[model samples]
Structure formats: C-alpha cells, structure tokens
Target: MNIKQYLDSTYLKTAFQTGISETENEIVVKNAIKEAIDEGFKLIMIRSEYVALAREMILQANSNLNVGTVIDFPEGKSSLETKVKEANEAIANGADDLDFVCNYEAFKNGDTELVKQEVLVATQIGLANNKTVKWIIEVAALSDKEIIQLSSLIKNIVISNFKEEDYASVFVKSSTGFYKTDDNSPNGVTIPAIIMMLENASPLPVKAAGGVKSYEEAIEMIRLGVKRIGTSSAKAIANGGNIPNQY
Candidate 1:
C-alpha cells in the first residue's frame, strides 16, 4: 500500500515537554515540516502556533501538502466559545484541517447535550470554511461502551444535521496522543478501540492516532478501515522501519 498518503506526519510537543528551549523546539518543528514536504506525506500536523510557519514553508516549496493543527489540544474540557475561537484562529493562520479534542469528559458525566452542541458548532465552522474537521474522542480516557457511544454520537450528529456530500469532510478520530493513564497502559489506538470506532462512526471516516508507531501497525489500521493514521514516526514508518515510544 502507498502508506504516505494515509499518514498525517505529526509533531505537537512544546518546548517544556521536550526539555528544550523554545527556539530549539521551533527548530524541531521546522525540521518536521521540511521532512513532511520532502517525504510527500498527506498532511503535517502541528500545534496551532506553527500553522503560519507550515503554511509559508508549503507555499515556498510549491507543495500540495496540507497543514493540520489541533484545537483545545489534549484536554477537551474547554468551553464551546473557546473551541470555536481557537478553530477560527487556526483557519485564519492557514490550517487545512482542524482536529478538535471532543468533550469526552462531559459525555461521561451524562452531559450529552453539551457534547452534541460542541460537535455541531465546531463542525459547522470547519465546513463553512471548506476545511476538514476531526473530533478526537481520546479513547484512552473512555471505556469500551463509551468509545462506541461517543463514536455513534458524532456520527449521528453529522448524519442528522449535515448534507450527505459534507459527511466526508468530518471525521471521528481516535485519540489526541497526549493523554496519560494512571497505570501506564496503552493510551492510544488499539485494535479493539478502532474496531468499535469504525463500526459506529461509519458514513463518517475514522482516523487512528496515538501509539501507532510502525509501518506494520499503520497498515493494519488502514486494513481495518481507518482512513488516516497520525504519528510522530512518519519518516521511519515511510521507510518501513519500526520506531517505538512515540505518539
């Protein structure tokens, strides 16, 4: 399979997280952008602060690579207004895809209306801007039943409110790649989790993120019917090598 097309080459670490200075961290981001361009990956997923940089680089190279940025990253507890504002800023800065962390906590707390409202509004902003929108459900933070329920929740929202042609523009993504579990478990996409998402989120595409580190694992996800795979090890995976311990 042509794996590069399915890969969203990602780097979302901050200076503090990487134990490096801000300047050094930016250098890392720049290198990642360059690598994505040279490798012809589908998209480059970075923090919103670097959206402008990725846009300028892609423009300079005259490449077709799209720029993707996260909104309300890692934590999905932000208010609806805050999420919309963040998504708008990312779009203005030239982001082609907006990956929003869904309010999974609220869903778990039995606040379905809040979750539905955010999905509807955030998706409207993205579709109106002619951008692809993804909802990161953070499967690591949920149980099996929650995963299926939340995936179906997103699917129902899109199907009920959006046009048929617009369905492809919205996706129910698996994780944020930054959630930590207390017992150090796999806090990312697992086969079971992905299966649940694919079955319930259908008609809307699914993206498998987090803990997908190797070419083999990526292929498996794609074969299991995920349309996209987000990983920090895109370069190694593209080269058919296995690199572990990355988001």
Candidate 2:
C-alpha cells in the first residue's frame, strides 16, 4: 500500500516544550529529518526555526522529500500580516508546504471577516509562490458544527477566489498536534472530526494531523479519504510498529 507516501513525518517540538537544551532539541530535529530522508516519507513537517536546516539536509541528501513548516503554530490568533510574513519566510527558507493555523478563534467570535481575510491572503501568498498550503483548523477546540462550518468556509473561499486546478493544492488540515483540552481529551484529529472535514471540505483535500499513532489508525484515516496523515511516529507506522504515548 506504500503508506510512506501518505505520511507527513512530523516533529514540531520546541526546546522549552521538551525541557531540553536548544542543542539537544536540535539534535532531535536533525535525526527526524535524517530519518524522513532515509525512510522516503512524503514530507517532513517541522517548526519554522528549523526550516532552513531541514532544507539544507534534504538538499544535501538529494532527497525528494518536501519540507513543510507551520505558520502561527498551535495558535490561530495571529494577525493576517504576521501570518503572511511567517509563511513568506518559510517559503524563502525552502518550505514546499505551508500549514497555516487558521484563526478559528475569530471565526468563533463572529469575526468571519478577519478569518476570511487571513485565509484569502495566506492562500494567495502560497499559491502565488507555487507552494502547497494547508489550513490547520485545530479540531479539538471546535464542535462538529464548527468543524463543518470552518471546513466549508475554507473550501468556499478557495473555490471563490482560486481556479479549479488550484483547489487540490489548498488543504483543510485537522490539527497542530499541540492543542490542550480541559478533560485531557484527544487534542488532535479524531474519527468524527476527520469525517466532518472530509464531508464538508470536498474538492479541497484533507490532511489528518495529531493523535494518529498506529499503522492501522493511519490506514483507517486514509481509508476514510484523507489525502495525508501527519504524525510523529512515521517510522513506527511505516514499519508496522506502534509508539505508545506519542502525539
């Protein structure tokens, strides 16, 4: 089934989050990049600070692995200008995919205009640069209705402003793999959430991120029609092993 091609090998932890020194955390990121190269995964998703390093490694290895970085990661409350600047910097640093954390907070607060503007501007920047773009909706923070609404919103915006051929390049990704919940519930993609996204964001593909651990689960997501599965345990999943307690 070549599940490796459907995986976006991800490592987005910061030094502070890992309670390690910057040098130590970088070592982790470097190993993840090298592992992605060796495993022939579809892409490597990392923090913005490591985009340049990832680019250098992938280029030196002559690997076809695409480099993806998050914009306003984990939090979607950043201003439109800030998101644009971050995305541009990632592109200049050689990121092939820009996974933007959409301003769902604003959308929830009845500020649809701001959300729409950011989606338009960010998608425009990415499409203009010939880069693939994905909007992270942080499904853990939203209800089913919100998921459908937001997914439809992104789909509608892309359909309205962009051409038909470009729709596939803009994805409605599920999570940032960093959201926290009150009951310590699953803070990433879930079956119900992914179903909602796929049902509502059709023609605009879906990328399931966060909480996808085992090869079986990844296969299930793919079976449910997600174009990509983002996970930290890419190697384990690719090899039919499981990494317990990994996000």
Candidate 3:
C-alpha cells in the first residue's frame, strides 16, 4: 500500500480508550471502555494497573483488539529504575504497548544523559521481555532548545534500542500537558516535529497522541508519519459527532 493508504489504515485505527480511576470517576472508566469496545473500537488504552483486567475483558469479547497501557504515566517523578521495572511488569501482565512519559525535569535541566538513561532502561526492559515501549515526549513542557535537545537524545536512544532490538513505538506527546513544570499551555503531538522525528528515526516510527479529537486532526497526524494515536474523542469522529461525550 502507498503511504497515504497506510496512513488511512492506521488513523484512528480504533478509538483510543482512556481511563480515570474509579475514585477519579465515580462512574468508572472501565465500564466506559467496555461500552466503547462493543461499539467497534479495536484499540484501547487503560492504566497499567488494569492491564490484566482489560486483557480478560477483551478476550471474553472474542474480538480482535489491542490493549495499551502507560509507563511513568502523567508523572515522571518516579525513579528511572522504577519506571523501567514498571514497564517490564506491565508487559508481563499483558500490556500490548507502552506509552511512557520521560523525566521532564531532567530533559528541561539539560540532563541529556539522564534522559537517555531513563529511556534506555525502559527500552531495555521492553526488549528483554518482547514488549513494546513508546517514549512520550510531552511536547508542551520544553523550550525550543529542550525540544531539539531531547529529540536528538531520543534519536540516539532509538538507535541504541534498535541495535539491541529493544525498539517499540516512539511518540511525541503533548499532555500529561503535564505537571512539574509551571507551563500549562494546551499542547499536542505537533505535526511538524512528528514528521521531523520520523524523518530522522526512519523505521523506528512514532505515535502521535493527545488533543486528537477529529477525523481531520487525526488524518493530519497520520500524514505527518504517525502510525498510531491516543484520543478520548473517538465517538465524536466515528459517528460524525453524533454521540457527544458528556464531559
């Protein structure tokens, strides 16, 4: 297939499934995912803790679906070593893909070595266990220097990971739009950087996530070389905006 065809095939490949802890959502996001999957979404993302439960649910549905979970999640405050272990553990339990958040403070402080180390550890864990790892470069938190710096670091890290065959999908993400830095601009996996990263990384590929809420935006990300997406705006796209989320 041509690049355009490949792009269309993967775009919104399925509505991305999201999670909010039951405590965070008295309505429980798991139930929402179940309903979403039934509605014909084949790709879903949930908390690392719920990996096994999600696996069981998907298996019982007897449908072709891939389940994704996070590592280091919305926070990069956890120790790098801990993040790697969490990645390994999540995969062992049944995570089809890992969307990992990098240590933002380290990247922001110009600690390239630390950033590489964190990514290295997690990628090693993923490779060791045949798991997939994706680096979520929260694009919103960086200065232009930080972005360019971390991008090189990720390139190096991906090279290292590839040499060892520890490769997973790498993503330039926009949110956790996250905390820890005082910046709170609504960010996303920008089309330009996504293209640049793919042009540089070649076969390693990238996943564009966050703020992806429509068929138009999703297609743009795909056009920019993203092989995957993360969005809560699934129903909006699938039904021509018919089933609006009540959030």
- Pick the lDDT winner: 1
Please give the distance, in angstroms, between residue 74's alpha carbon in candidate 2 and its true position after superposition.
Answer: 1.2
lDDT of 3 at 8: 12
Better of 1 and 2 by TM-score: 1
List the candidate numbers ranked by lDDT, top first.
1, 2, 3
Ranking by TM-score: 1, 2, 3
How many Å off is the CA of 242 in candidate 1?
0.7
lDDT of 2 by residue, 109-192 (tens): 889899999999999999999999999999999989999999999999999999999998999999988888999999998999
TM-score of each: 0.99, 0.98, 0.78
Clashes of each: 0, 0, 0
Against the true structure, candidate 1 reaches a TM-score of 0.99
What lDDT score belongs to each candidate, Candidate 1 first? 0.96, 0.94, 0.61
Candidate 3, backbone clash total: 0
Question: Where in model 3 is the C-alpha error above 4 Å?
Answer: 1-27, 39-42, 164-174, 177-184, 242-247
Error of 3 at 132 (Å): 1.7
User: lDDT tens string, model 1, 1-247?
Assistant: 7899999999999999989999999999999999999999999999999999999999999999999999999899999999999999999999999999999999999999999999999999999999999999999999999999999999999999999999999999999989999999999999999999999999999999999988899999999999999999999998989988898
The whole-model C-alpha lDDT of candidate 3 against the native structure comes to 0.61
- Report clash pairs, candidate 1: none
